[model samples]
Every structure is written in structure tokens, then in C-alpha cells.
Target: MAHLRDQPAGVDGITIDWDAPIRVSDGTVLRADVFRPTEPGDYPVILAMGPYGKGLHLADGYPANWRRMHEAYPEVAHGSTGRYQNWEMADPEKWVPDGYVCVRVDSRGSGRSPGFLDVLTALQARDLYECIEWAGQQEWSNGKVGLLGISYFAANQWQVAALRPPHLAAICVWEGFADHYREGARHGGIACEFVKGAQARQMFTVQYGMGSRGPTDRNTGRPVAGDVDLDDDVLRQNRRDLYAELLARPVNGEFYQERSADLSRIEVPLLSAGNWGGMGLHTRGNVEGFLAAGSELKWLEMHGDTHFNPFYNDRGLGLQKQFFGTFLKGEQNGWLDRPPVELLVRHPGERFEPRFEQEWPIARTEWTEFHLCPETMELRTSPGASGTLSYQPEHEDLRFRLPPAGHDREFTGPAAAKLRISSATADADLFLSLRLYDPQGTEVTFIGSNDPKVPIALGWLRASHRRLDTDRSEPYRPVHSHDSIELLVPGEPVDVDIEIWPTSIVVPAGYVLELGIGGRDYSNQGTEIENAMYPTTGVGPFIHTDPEDRPAEIFGGAVTLHFGPDVTSYLLLPAIPAP
Candidate 1:
């Protein structure tokens, strides 16, 4: 029988269930921490499934992230004891009091759950689908389930929603990358070393094995992975090697498709939210899902600064509640009455101007062209003369600086560049870094997902994988079909279009735009800021350093850039005209 009760430890009238068992169709039991009202009644469910252990508290499992967020915004952890706060998962203390049941599940092999640990695979996605159905059928469930979380948690939504589970009602994809290959393992065609580093830092710590691989929380004597024990050998065999698996897939087709969000199949109402500073992994996927999803009822929201701050803080939490209230609770809260798009137009000094629009790349976007003059190293609109520049692949990058904008201009969308180049070898990797320098010549940077010193934008392409998926591409964003290798002919020029991911910045009058075309990653002279996850490098751990992926013999050779009226190499930028 449904009964209403209150706990002395919780807010008045709220009920909470810890370590609930949710068995999948295959009989594998996944552990979930369920937070709901004590009142015996059907309430909607908010589910977050990830490999991160459900037993791990945000304050304990990720102290650095927690500290950083609290220091920046104390109010996020203010109203509650925050004891139930798990990394990247909803705080039961917050949702339970609001009449919604929040369920956080540790996937197959993480936390106290026992099963094979195959991260982001189709098998894992299927397990999630079963979980949603299970939640819907629960005694306390109202039969409506919604998915919400960050990164791993959000990425799973894209995959599971594609299956179109009956009980699935809505989704909030916050800062999650969709394309496993392009946005994940390989950026353009280069393998990101960040994958392996991330595995070692995050996954290896809580991986389910013989003994708990996590630390015992100071507050709770139990280990972060739980106080469970298992046979070492069996545990080792059950966990899939996430890093090795990424290294094995060089091309995107079936394997990538299986893990990627199939937008065509995701018909549920969803809210796609991204961060302007999350250039590498997150922002692109948010925009892509919003633009291409099969969902007819969708909205887009974007912000800047700490990626972790917004989700838990009041500014973000309020918006999230509104999104879920209308969809999950069927609240008549005029959510559909406002503009469909929300943006935090960023300027220098971490200041963001709040704005609302009817569409992305607002209808009045002025597509501007900045032609490169290889000789003078100037970026201008009109062609000056034919020029050619060449450099050994291992040598310094060729940089061109554009004249400062005459007025305060907002360049706030996806960008692309056409390069006319020939290589001495059969293959060449073109690394493009789009940067902005202040009037005083200091590089303007922003906080990327993990890196604090990320540039304005970045892009990459291999001459071999330069074939564009014309139907899935736009002039400002060239989508490359990284399926087959179209190797370059020695000493012959080929036109390559590279897609620079979405960007949002309001450049002041005297700031200049700089473009760096290089054979390697761009580095800065500024002192690396010490951070929790990684020591500051020009880029974050997202650097491409896998030797097997980029052989010195094949990718290292002489390269050249040709530009003029005949060649017409230019950078396409989405410039929003001043209102």
C-alpha cells in the first residue's frame, strides 16, 4: 500500500530509498539510489545511468570538481546537506522534495552492481532502455521517465532514446558529445590522447574489480565503489578495456554509428543545452542534436564559464526544473510561450549578456569572408595577389593575422576554412587554430571542458579523409565523411574544407582575429595555470599524441598553402550583425 511518511533527517514530508535493486530483462541487477516522496503515489522519474559508481558522492569522488564549483557558486550546495550529491547525477535531496523521483544507476559493472563493464557500447545502451521500462513499472512511478545528466550520463540519453522506449518522455542533453568518433576518439582524423588519459583518471579509479579501487570517504566509511568484494581475475575479465577499444577503431561507420545518437530515431521532446567554452567535446554535439534531431518539440540553451557550475547552480537548476516540469509533470507553465533559443553572449572578462532568439545563427547572420595572403600574412576580404608559403611538416606553423574589426562584432556560430594545399607525402594532417588577440597582444582564451586555456576555436583534417558529406554539411560547417582515406598525390594541390566547431564571442573593436595553419598543435607562451584535472597545456589532454595513429613517416613531410583569386582560399565565419 502507498503510504506517506517523513524522515527526521530529510526535509519535511520527503522520503528517500537508498540502494534499490532494479533488475534488467537479462536478470542482471543494477543498483539505483531512488529519491521520492514518502507519500505513496505515482510520480515521474528522472533517470541518470553512467559507469560512475552510484555510491560515489560528488564531494568525495570528485573533490576538485566539487570544490571548484562550490568556490565559484556556493548556493548550489547551499539549501541541502548535499550528502546525496553524486558526480554528474542529480542530488536526490533536491529532487525528492519537489515531488519527483530521481534514480541514479551505476551501469553493469560499476559501484555495487556486478556485471561486465562495457562503456558506451550498444549492450550498455540496451541495459539503459530496460532500466527506463523498469522505472516506469515501479510502484512509485507515474509511468513517465525522463533522462538528464552531464557527459557520460547525457551521452547515453542520445543512444537509449533512439530506441524510442515507450515510457521515455523527455531528455535534457547537457554538455554531452553525440558522435563517438569525430567528437570523441578522433578529432577530425587524429586520435585524441585525452581518451586514454581520461580512462586512467576517471574510469580506472572506480572500475569494479577484486578490491574497491576507490578511496574510503571520510564522512562515510564505505569506499566510493562500495564495500563490495569480488574475485580479482573474474573482475578483470568482465571490464572491457575502454582505451584499447578506442584505438582499434580508425574509421567511423557501424561501430561509431552504434554509439552515436541517431537523431532520426529520437522523437521525444528534448532540451539541448551546451556550453560556449566546451569547444572540443560538448558544444558541437549539443548544437548538432538541436539542429538535426527528429524531435519536433525542442529548445536550445547555451552558457559559458565552468561546465560543472551551471548544471547544479540556481541559474541552471531553475531552467532545468522548468524544462522537466512542463514535460514530466505536464505542468501548464507557459514553457512553450517564450523564444525557443536562449544564449549567453560572451565578452571579455567572463561576462555574458543574456539574450533570447527565435533561431540559432540568428536569421540576420552576415556570412563574412577573410582571405589569406600568404606573403604578407594578412587576412583581408579582397584578394591582393597570388602567394605561396611552404614549410617542413615538422617545422613552425604558418600564421596569418586579420585586421581588427572596426566595431564591436559578434562571431557566434560554426566556422569553416578552405585550404589549397599539396604535400610531398601521400598524406598530411592540417591542424587549424582560430584565435583572437586583445589590443595589447595577449591571447584571448576560455575554459574548455577540461582545459582552462582553450583558444577561441580549433579544427583538424587529414588530406586523406577530406571527402565532405555534402548532404549533411553547410557552407560554414563542412561535414567530413571520415569513412575512407582519399590519400594525396605527391606534389599535387587539393582543396580541403575543414569544419571549425561552433563558437561564441563578442570581439571588441581593437581585437584582431588570427588563424594558424599548422602541422602540429598550437602552443602558447603563457604560464600554464595549475588545475585539478590536468596541468595547463596550450590545449587540454585532448592533444593527439598516439604514435600509431600519426606515423612520422606518413604524416611528416613538406606542405604548402596557396591563396589568391584563382585559388580563393578563405575562412567562412557566421557573423551576427549588431542589432
Candidate 2:
């Protein structure tokens, strides 16, 4: 194996090898660079293996991500010089001083390694197992290993941890989803628009030298780090394009299970952190992983703000250090004695108020039911005096408005809408938005998983695909089985319950809570805002929309909101207690 040399300067007590080749299964020599204590007899290793090249410097590897982190939370650069910053992973400078070995590996066939690159499939998990075992046996390692990373890295950690590598002690999954088919790549039986652009902008473009790994490195001046012999065809065959591939298998097929982490098999201590703002990819995973994983010593923390900010902020870093110290270092930090769940309830204008709770949904949460009155198209706390309501696609997407009381309203946890509808057509697409309208009747929109324009929190379900997994269903979350599609009769009103993914908001007294039922995605509601673009990945912010699979004739029909007469539609809200 060819060994890469280290830079002379050291940070704290650590020295780093700029580029080192790590051999994986099947004789593939992938690359990783390590930062370890100089006086190391042995130290618990904090390892992250991903598509991001290990040799690539953060200043050069992810200039856009680096710039954004510093701009949002300037304190990241407070104590030390920023040299080892990388995407969605810990800064080596922060960990080395604590006597931890930080190793970053470029996944096989990515970055300097010559082979094929597949993202989070079974092949990648096998390579990760090997990496874990390899780290345990290294001279610099004390044989205990833990995993930490965000997004891509965090997703893979779940997969490999399920394999139960002997040396793998604990894991911190920061906003990583457990079910690939349901949350990531595809949602509501449709492929994600974000992954479609991500492939060209983030994956192959950087691998093939089309994006910000640039034409060459400014510092090394070598042909950037992982420029290999791969072209479009090789990239195509080796890695499955998540967006297109997921579209083919709309059902919960074998493909989804192959990549999904079996939470039942994950037995190590887990710290699952989620962001309130992460709607599509991450929000479900963190909450689901904590609730489902077999780990007896598991904890959950929820925060708000941009996806990447919470991981490095003082609050995030402090929690990370405390958890890792307890599990990895075997310290008596009392972390295990802490509450099982904590939430940073977010207020308007980027304010977060932390609340330590014993369990999710908070025991004191009032599961308030807001019924949808069809005649007035308003949400009310009481069941309507009239019968059920009916609505159809051609009808202006039904909007229900309800005014807040004299006091402000605070809501947290998952939301659900129960609807009774009769569609003239066989199938209907259910698009529900939990919206907030100002006193002037203007819709309030915030940053969403996709759609830079106006977007209130959204939920979707197909009428035919409305079967629930009765065993796992909860009042706040309706767990869809996605097994069979039950076509509705022409004139019969049927009850359909829709799961609105978790959300947090503080509604002022003047604002009104509104729910919109429509057929297709809402895109043109507001002007698009230009968020920061990812320089290294070349992918902009995540974008999502209802794809073309839902034809107008099949989904769009004359629906009747059978209210005032008999049918009743209602929205379920998890109302939080006032502080």
C-alpha cells in the first residue's frame, strides 16, 4: 500500500497524515487521513467514512460549506484555527485535544481509490464493517470505536451499526433516516427531486472533476484529490442513482429493505439528534430511529435552525462531547442518567427555548382535535353540527381557516388530518398543508425540504394507498403500511387519515391556522429565495415536488367535502403547554 505523508504542523496534541490509503474488502485500497494524539498509547477512535475525500482539505474540500458554517455561527472559529473542517462531520481540532483519534475515509471507488462507488447500499455497509474492524486493530486505537457524522455519513452509520461490528461501541446519528424508501430518495411513493440534482452536482461531478474539487487543488496543485479513471458510464453502473432508481420501485420492495437499517438489530447506545426545520429527509429518521432501535440506552434530542448549524454550535458540541465521553471514554459523566428526550422548542426569528422532557410527545401534551367544517371550510375544536364534508381536485383546493384564541398557540410533535371524501374517480392524491395565515390573509411560508418559494409544512397520501399499519399507528403519526391500494367506490364517502410529519411553530394571537387540501404540489405560491449553494457538492439546497407519476385524471376529480350534512374532517394537533 502506498502511504501518504503528514503535514508537519500539529494542532493541540495531534498530527495528521494528509493522505493515507486504507485497504478495504476485495483488495480495494481506499484512502483516509487520521489525526491522533502524539502521546497516544491507545485512544477510542471516532471514525467517519463517506464519499467526501479524506485527502481534500476543508478550506479546499468544502469551501461553500465552510463559509456558510462560519457565517451562521462565527463561534466555530473561536478557540482554534480552522484547518480540519469538513462537511457534516466533526472538526478534528475539537476532538484531538480530548485524546480521541479522528479518521476520515473516502468510500471505496470514491476519492483517490480506483473502483466503483455506491452510496448507502449493502456493499458500502460491508466496506464500513471492514473499516471498523481495521480501526480497532490499529496501533493508535484502543480497540473501541464509535461512529459520528451527518447526512451521508450518518445514514451509513445506521446501516453498518446494524451489522454489529465487534469494536463498534456507540453511534451519534445526526438527522439520518432509518427507512430509506419512506423518507429519503422517495416520499409518498414518489422519487425525490433533490436526489435527482444531487447526483450530478454532488456525487459524479466531484468524482469526475466537473465541480468544486475544481480542475485542480489550489494548495496541493495536484489534480485535486480523488480524480480517477471513471467516466459517466462507470459512474452509472457502480452507483445507483437514488432519484431515478427510487421512482421505478414505488412500492416498498426489496430494494428499500436492502438499504434500510434494521433498527431492531442496532443494540449499542445511540444519540439521535433531529432538526425541526428538516421536513423531508431527516426529521422522520431521527425520531423514528430513537423510538424503534433496540438500543436499551438510547436518547433523543431535537433542535431547530439550519440542518448543519446544530451539530457545531455550542449547544450541539457540548452535548456531543458529553455523550461521547460517557460512552466512548467510559467516563462518569452522568449522561446516561439524563432524560430520554430533550427538545429545543423554536420561536420566531431564530430563537430556541430548550426544554428537558422525559419522553417524546411530552406527557403533558394536549392531543387537541381541530375538526374541519366543510360548509365554512374552517377548522374548529368542536365536531361540526353538520354531517361529513366532501372535496375534489377541480374545486379550488379546500382551505380551512381557524383563528387562535386570545393567547398565543404553541404546537409540537407530528400532526394528522382525518378526512371523509367521495371521489368520482377511482383514485385521488391527498396533499395537505398545515399553514399559518397572517391577519391580512397572506400565507406564511418558511424554508422547507424543497421549494425555495412559499411552503408551509406539507403531508401527502394517495387515496388508494391509505392502508395503515394498525400495530404501529399513533394519534400523532399515522404509520402507512404501503402494502395494498384500496380503490374507493364512486359515491361512497370513506374515511382517510393522513400523517403530517412532525412540526414546531409558535402562532401569534393574530395569526390563523389554515389547512389546504390540494391535488398537486404547491410551487408558485411565492417568489423563490436564493439560499447558499454548496460549492464542493455543487448541489444547491434540497428541493422536492410531486412528480409526474400522479396523473391529473387519476388524482384530480370532483371531490365533495360532505360537511354541514354528515361527513366531518378534522386536523389533529399536538398542542404544547405554555412555559
Candidate 3:
């Protein structure tokens, strides 16, 4: 049963239906909150379904992110009361007045809804598809629905859209990853600790049945989790142990296949907005989604900023309205006349200039290779004399630097590194970092997705999972197959290809580019930001520090780099020419 309420005459002029029951195929009743215009007319719908509690206000649920976002861009809260602002979802106050109904639903077992909690599975996608159909049949709906949100909300859109829901018109995937195996739980076949931290701090806190333990919704003065509280043991039994499952399944098997999206099956209009700073998690998905999706009408937009900033800022909001207005409202807004790709060209001092393009990897990209010379510790155009270098995997890092640029140069798009190496142990893990230094030799870092300081690009790979999917491999991007592992033979050198996520940066005449390779995560002597949830180091929270995943006996051994005429290692870059 829904409890309908009309706003006061002077208030925002929007009506709300709280705790609306949306029955799915299995007779499970999900809960949603619908915000519609008070004028009583049919309008297009913008629906968002996720595990985050719909009633948990942004300030209450994620205080650090909320404060930092507002402080950086005050315009985010300029036009509305900020009461309906939830984590990563659209604001009802902004959408209702623009002739669009905003629908925020609590996924199966979160918030006011009750069921088994399983995040990012086929079951969740089916529930979303049913919710879309339900929204299309509403009396106040104009029979058109659009999907929009950030991170988790955006990631699921790729899965549900593949089902080809009749009412889903368009989707704007803002900083979302599509592959669960590569971008979600593991990177380069090494277990990442991000999922464990996120599950504990973000999901379990607001899970359904928290009752008195959960925060109260400021607007309704009721518990955000639900009306009844369950014991700790019962709550544990209701939800799947996501971290445990990831550790148990180390390869790309049936477990990961069910969570990853089938990009070829998605045929709806798509606008994938990715961030240059989101190297580890968000960048790869957006670029891959834009290229692999079967949609005839698709566009890609890349920007440089904090993950949450660009989605709510004026520039981001404008692009969203222009896209949704043309698709859902049947308006001739000239959106289709624009190019299919938009890039925010990055320059020194955190500046970005927007440019439109015809395709990704910019059709005119010059694929340049910088050969690694171990003898001189430099990246040169030609291979150097045979030399060998060894370092302790657990304690030391090896760096190779390129000479100062003679003129301004721009490197934009995907990158790859091919290395020939040997290990004293059976296996080893490799971490790569591309860094920039100014004329004074000071490192230049950018604001990453979750951290305040980040490198130009980062990549990781466990030596054993070095097999490539040759069919999908490109000159600039190397795709890895994590189905099985092939341990290395002691003192034997093998060639391995590593894929560095997409990035964009302009280097001035005196600036230098350096590549760092090590067996551990990259870090520098920088102060952590006050509002960052994790230490604002180079990699943020996407770290691979699990001892069980990288045992001391196998991974923490002497690693050797062999350079010779027969075994030449090099870095592949996508250098864009000045137009």
C-alpha cells in the first residue's frame, strides 16, 4: 500500500507516493518512491533502481563525499531544497519541474523492500526489467522510461538494457563498469580489497531490516531500513557473502559471467560518460561499453574530475538534459547532429578543454612505441644493448624515464606495455604506473575517482594469468584471459602484455614522462585529503594487499628484467596529433 501526500502550496510543487508496492514476477513486493509533477499530466519517467537505500539522504549516508562535492561545486545545491538528494541518484526537485517523473526504487533486499540480498546478478536485472514495465503502465507516465545514475546505479543499466525492455528509451551510464571479473572484484587476476571495504561500509550499513540501528529519514521521520529490526545472525543469513564468493572463484567462471553485462545485446540509445581520472574501475567500462554496444545511436563523453563531481555539475547536468530531452520527449534538440564522441582534453594545472570527435581512439592516433633500455634506465626509440636488472619484489621498484619533450605532446586513449621478465619463484605480480613530472622535477598528480592524488595511468597483472585473448587484442589495448594460470619456470624469461586503462594528458616542452614497475601498489609522500574515505594515495582503495592471494613464498621473490636483442620490452602509447 502506498501513502500519498501533497506538498504545501508554497513548497516545491511536487507530489510524493511513499512506500509504493511494485510486485515482480515471483510475487516479491519491492518498494519505490515516485516523485511526479503536481499539475496532474503525463510525463516521461527517469527510473533508478539500486541497493542503496532510497530514503538514506546523501549527507547522512556518505557524509565525506557529500561535504566534498558540495564544497567543490556549490551549484549542486543551488536550485533545490536538497532534501531528496540520495547517493548517486537524480534529485527529484530538479527533475520534477523539468517535465520528468523521478522514480527511485530500493532493490530486492535493501531499504524498505524485503527479500534475499544478492547484488549484481541476473535476478536483480530481472527485477529491474519488471520495474520498468510497471513504471510504463502508470497512469501519470507517458509510456517512456529512461535510465540514469552513477556507479552502482549506472553499472546495472548495462545488464537490464540487454533484456530489451520495451519501455526503456535511453540510458546515461555515468562512470560505471560493465565487466565484473576485470573491473569489479579483480584486476589482472589479482584479488582486490575494494569489494570487501565497499560491502561493509556502504551496503551492509543500510541493508533491509536494520530498523532502529539505521538512520532516520529526515523528511518522513521514519527508519530508512524498515519498520522491523532483525537479529545480526538473521541478517547474515539473508544476504550473500560477496567477498567470500569472489575469493572462492578466482577465475572468470560461471560466477562472474552472470554478473557481467553482455554489451552486444544492448540496443538502446546510450551516452557513456567516463572520467579520465577513474583509471582503475570506471574508465575501461565506459570506453568498452561505447565501442561494443550494438546500439546504432550511441555517444561517448570523457571528462577529468572527481567521480561524483562531473555527474552533478552544471556541465554534466546540461548534457544529460540535452540527451534525455531529445530521446524521451521527442524534441528536435539537435543532439543527433553532434559528433558521437566528446573528450575533455587535459592540460597542465588541472585544466580541460572540450572537443568533439567522430570516433574513439581518435581515427588519427599515432601508435608510438618507446623501447625499454635497462642498461641506461631510459625509454628510447631504439633498443639498447643487452643488460639485466634485478630487484626485490616486496621492497623495491624499477623506474625508466623518457627524455624531456622537445615540444608539447598529447597522449590520449588506451595504452599497453610488453615486458620480458623472469622470477626466482613460481609466480609474481606486476604493478605499473605512468607518471608525469614538471620542469622542476616535481610529480604532477590529478584528482582521481576516490582519491585527491593519482598518476597519469595504472595497470596490474599476476604473471601467471598472462595469456591474451588474441581475437580481441588490439595494438594499443591488450585483453587478458583469466580462465587459467601458467606458473613461470625459475630463471626462465617470458613475454607478457599488460593493459593500461585509458587516459588523456598534455605534456609541455620541459615535462618528463616516467614508467614505474613494481610488485606492490604505487604510493608517494602526499598528505591525505580530509574528506576522502580512504588514504588519498595513488591507487585509492583499489588495492591488492591480500596475503593469501599473493603468498610471500611465491610472489615476494627476486624479480629480474632481461633486456636484449632477442627479448625487447617496450611501451605502446596512443599519441594524438595537433589538429
Candidate 4:
């Protein structure tokens, strides 16, 4: 074949001799390193293609990740030789031990593969499609293929599955984001500051720039993948700098849509895994992708804690096996009849309680509203008399607390806040946080997506990027029409409705629901969680404060609150049913 390359030494399949790299219609050579049972027969193949060098062991590819993972998750070290372990994805040790054949290929410009790396482009999807067909034709392959991985590996799975490759059977997308524009890279019309800052260290260097950043084979002193000479200059040319480029253009528009996957075309059987604490990278997309994808046989499972742990834990692994057994093997595993939605509801003190429900925004949810009382800065059942609470440059932001519900309450899913606002400046930024305070007056912060130590749900905004997209606007989520901006008039309060991202929490009895409103972001303080694996500020995870993006002059302003006769402000919460 024109695109095929020479077979490497350790790549021959034990069960059936596999063909070397084969060319596809697109004229691109893709190399595959394979593992199969030492028997002469065909079997379903599990395929994964990404920049993490296939031949590279975790200890060599990313030593820090290896050290941290094993330190936190000792079970990862219990299996086979641990030759196939990688960061933030499936432990190949578990998969290869089973009957399934595992194949890993380096994406173009990464590992041994040669080319300029373009992260998650339409062309990348084309390459994956070819790889699927190539895998199916292998001598040991049963001509049926399934895909599975976390984050980058899983995100592209959605893209290629939409193409509906003939040999493709099923897929498990673990903690993958859905839309590149709205749900990822950019949030609330703003570039994700955390991803922007950590991209180079977290993704590029290991994947493309440096072949082996960890221990080397004592004999050759070379990487397990190839030559380890890949350095900084090569990294600069390897892939499009997603985090940096996103920072230059902080608003959503055509530039962001190029990489976003169109979910309407995806029709294969799919299982989406989500993490509750994965606020920064993986959380939103998992939730949105599950709801948006066109798959009829689809399931969503959400859990708490470090993003990757739950997926590989005993419980996570068991669920994945049952799901694959039913879908890929055509077995009558109970997965076919399992509930559509499953959640590991978290309580205080690191306790996780399991709950299985049919759908999200649970069926028995009570969509309730609490109005802002202007006079006393309190959240009341109804509006107060005519008056206003205004925050000038010298005044503090208005704070309000709602009376505790007699019984415990569960608030989950998306929430909304309606505000009547006037700006002294032409444009204004509004920061709102719906919080829960305990009986001891301790503010509760759940694990956020970006910062692991603090507790906060979804965050959102309107940079006045555009006027409201009237057709898509709803009480719970305000769909902004990023088409035009209407300048504000001083002293005139415009009815600006803000949509907060989804979150899940069970408020204990005697706990008060508090809402913090301000012209700028609130400080992430109080509780500091310990973790040697991830970066942390003084007390906890790093808080985002880019002077260029979050300057007080541009975002901070004196804003008024109206709960009495003159104005009304309130938050709409997705209240879940009590047990």
C-alpha cells in the first residue's frame, strides 16, 4: 500500500500476524503498534489514536503523572507490566489482559508519526476515520472496532464516529467535552484563563515536543518511542496553540466554531462519562455532549473527585465493562436495561452516595424562584417595596441570604438570575454566585472544574458580546445573540437576565442559601485543599486574575440592586426532589 510503512519489531500480533501500516484513500501513512491474544483467529479491536506515544510507557512519557497517579491510585500499579499506562485515560493494563486487542497509533506530528500537528481539526477526523478502517483489516481483527479514551482521545472519537466508519461498532467517551466553542476553550464569551496558562506544560511538551521527558532505557539512553531530541522549537511548530490563540480572541464567533463538533450527525451507540469536580476541562462538555448528540442508544454517568480517578476505579471500570459487553459483544448484559442517568451524589466530608435516576434535571424538580429584597439585601419569597441597593465605587457589593428550607433540599442542574441594571460606564460586567452557607456560617465550596479545592458550580456571563438571541432565550438559560451590542444609558436599568452554569448539591437542614453579587469576580478564599499533584495558590487552587482581561477599571463599577417597589431581582434554582 502507498501509505504503509515498515513494521516495527514488537508489533506482530500473537493471535494473527497483522499487516504493516496501510495507506488510506487520503494518502497518509499511519503506523500502528498492536497487541492481541496469542491465538490464530479474528477478534474485535479496541483502537486509540492520539499524541501520547503508543510505544512510550507512562514512567517515561510523563513521570510526574505516573508518580501522582500511583501515589493516589495504587491499584493502577497492581496489574500487568504497567507498560501501557498513560495519563488521564484508560490503563491499558486492564484492557489488554482481557480478550480485546489494543492498538495505539501516534497522531501526525506527534511521536513517530511525521507531519504538522493540527489539534482536533476536520482533517484530524479524516485521519482517524482512515485509522479505523485500517484497524479493521488487520489479520487478527474481527472487522468490528470500538473506541474508548478520556479527554483528547475521547473528544475526537465523537468527531470520527459522526462520519460513521463502516467497521465502527461502539464507543465510550470518558470526560470529553462536547462543543469546542460554547462549552470548551471559551466560557461565557470569555477565554478560559486556566487552560490558557497551563497548556504548554500539560499538553504540548509531552505529546509532541519531547519524546521522553522521564526516565530513559539505561542501554540506549533514547526514548522508548524514538529519538528524544524533539525540543522547544519543534513544539512551537507542532500544533496550533489552542490556549494562546483563544486568549487573543476572548469572545465566541466564527474562529471558535472551526473545531467544534457537530453532534447532530453522531448516531452510533455512545456512553458519556462526566466528573462533578471537573469544572475546568471536562465537566461541561460531557454534560452538553450527552444532551446534544443524536445517538439513540446513549447513556450518561456522572461522578465526583479527581476527573480521571472515577473512570478507572473499581466502580468505573465495572460499569465500562458491562457497557461494552452489551454493545460491542451483543451480550445480554444488564447495561442495555440500566437507567439512562446515574450519579454519585456527594455529601460533605468526602462521602459519595449513589443515586440512579431516569433523566437529568430530575423529573420531580421544583423550579423555584427567590426574589431580591432591596431594603435589607435579603433574598425573600416576594419583592419588597419601592427602593434600591446600589454599589458605588466606594460601596461594597450587595449580599443576601435566603431563609433555610425546613427540610434538606437538593439543587441541581442549570440556574438563572434576573437583574435590572444601569451602568455608569458604557459596558459593565456582572459577577453572581449562588452559594450555600452552613448553620455554623461556614461558606461551602464544592470542587470546581478549574480549581479542585474550592466548591462552586457552573459560572457564566455576558460581555455584552451581542444582543439576546430572542428565539433561543428561556427563563433558565439566556441565549445571547452575539450579533450586536446595545450601548447602555446611565441611570436607566436594563433588564439583563444571566444564565449560570449547571451544578449539583444537597443543602443540609439549617443551611442557608446565599447569593453573592458584585461588579467583579469574588476572591476564592477560606478553604485550602492539599494536593501535591496539581498547582495551588496560598490557600487552594490558583484563582484567575489576568489584569489585561479582568481589570477593575473595565469590569468593576457601581451597580444598584432593586428588591423593593422600584425594582425586582431574583434567582431561579433547579430544586431537586427530596428522598
lDDT for each residue of candidate 4 in 310-329, tens digit (9 for 90 to 100): 76667778887787777666
lDDT of 3 by residue, 196-239 (tens): 88878777877898989988888777788888899999999989
Q: Can you tell me which runs of candidate 1 are displaced by over 4 Å?
A: 1-14, 217-221, 226-233, 525-531
For residue 16, model 3's alpha carbon misses the true position, in angstroms, by 0.8
TM-score of 2: 0.89
| Descending-lDDT candidate ranking | 3, 1, 2, 4
TM-score of each: 0.94, 0.89, 0.98, 0.86
Give the runs in model 2 whose Cα sits over 4 Å from its true position: 1-6, 9-13, 55-65, 208-227, 385-396, 438-456, 487-492, 522-548, 564-568
How far residue 573's Cα lies from its native spot in candidate 3, in Å, is 0.5
Q: What lDDT score is found at residue 70 in candidate 3?
A: 91
lDDT of residue 469 for candidate 4 = 74
Candidate 4 ranges with C-alpha deviation above 4 Å: 1-26, 52-73, 207-235, 390-398, 447-450, 483-492, 519-523, 526-544, 550-553, 562-568
Better of 2 and 4 by lDDT: 2
Better of 1 and 2 by lDDT: 1
Per residue, candidate 1 scores C-alpha lDDT tens digits across 469-493 of: 9998888889998998888888899
Please name the candidate that would achieve the greatest lDDT relative to the true structure.
3
Residue 57's lDDT within candidate 1 is: 75
lDDT of predicted model 3: 0.89
Q: Which ten residues in a row have the lowest lDDT in candidate 2?
A: 534-543
